[model samples]
Target: MTSSPDTQPIVVGIDPDPTQWLALAWAVDEATRRRLPLRLAHAREAPPSKYRTAELTPAWETWDEALRTLGTRALEQVEAFVRDRRPEVEVSVLLVEGDAASVLRGQA
Candidate 1:
């Protein structure tokens, strides 16, 4: 089937983890084969367990900083990989806030 360049065939959800990158790579290959655009979406999620609790000196700041670093690195890696491997696939990056479902629904 023919596809439109303006329409993305796959929307990849990226998180603060390496697994998301693997999924993105797979989606890129699939979109390329289908001749469709690839959209990258990154979301920031709070961990289930509190990684940092407020203390005399405010330890939450440390936890927040660490999570931010992880998320930033993950996004950067995804962007670089997409640019290098699928430059012709029409890639777009999205920065989203909140949980995955909420952000995705809002985007939709």
Candidate 2:
């Protein structure tokens, strides 16, 4: 039986790392098989860095842009993976703006 959004089992706690993609993909497949919902959670906070007061330059901007572009590309890869492998899975993407592990743990 298909589950409603409110009643569906939610597969949550996905990390924004390439290594975690397999687990996320599996979760989506499992959710599809069980007729549940899949939640893809990602954190948007800047990564912990030791040098916070460093001066910014044009090169720094370019590097930041590259990183942002890479992240977007990586997320698209995840979307493509789910769409291709678990087309029937009901999925929701959440972009939380804080420590990912902490936020996800609280959600669970």
Candidate 3:
């Protein structure tokens, strides 16, 4: 869905890495200055595995859980970082499941 008139539109790429913190900081500052909303997104890659379909059933579930947890943590950290720096800025978090490049492209 598209953003509403009241909704601000500033999208930023986020990761568990420290480098993302710099980008997030910049995006948060810009969003705050422009009175826009900030969208922090993290893309997860689910690559095909060598395991057989039957063997992958349980493994897939475990892997999916791990990825979800990691994504949640990353989003939480980024959100906290933004709030700590710019508490008044509006921020939203997104966790997209797919290849990083493709997910980012789709969002754009």
Candidate 4:
């Protein structure tokens, strides 16, 4: 794995799934070993409603809040995971409103 120095922090795009954490583990390991900061980013955009034709969607605000809540929970879980492994490693989190790919790219 390529190591980032102190100047550039290693960024990791964390998903909503708490059970899936291999990527986070690798990112934390690399950051601690390379002595760089770790960034945990999760995008928060309401997913497309499958019931558009039936007009059976929840309130717009409610859906948006749900997405943000999920993103926040995911970030917290990953942060705890990182802290548990290496307490000394620096870690930051970003919960942005956009697509996952775009959010991560913007972090760069």
Highest-scoring model, TM-score: 3
Give lDDT tens digits, candidate 4, residues 1-108. Answer: 333454788899997776788888999999988888888999886456563433545566677778888888988988998999988888989999888888888887
Q: Superpose all Cα atoms of candidate 4 onto the true structure and report the RMSD in Å to 1 decimal.
A: 4.7
Q: Is candidate 1 or candidate 4 better by lDDT?
A: 4
Q: Candidate 3: RMSD over Cα atoms?
A: 3.3
Give lDDT tens digits, candidate 3, residues 51-83. 638867988888888999999999999999988
- The TM-score values for the models, in the order shown, are 0.62, 0.64, 0.83, 0.80
| Sliding window of 10 residues with minimal summed lDDT for model 3 | 1-10
User: What is candidate 4's CA lDDT for residue 60?
Assistant: 63
Worst 10 residues of 4 by lDDT: 49-58
lDDT of 3: 0.82
- Tens digits of per-residue lDDT for model 2, 1-108: 356657645646554476867777778778877788676666555544653345645555676666566556666667677778877776666655567678677656
Between 1 and 2, whose lDDT is larger?
1
Give a tens-digit lDDT track for model 1, residues 23-68.
8789888878888777677676765555434452355566566767
| Model 3 spans > 4 angstroms off | 1-8, 49-52
- Pairs that clash in candidate 1: none
lDDT of 1: 0.70
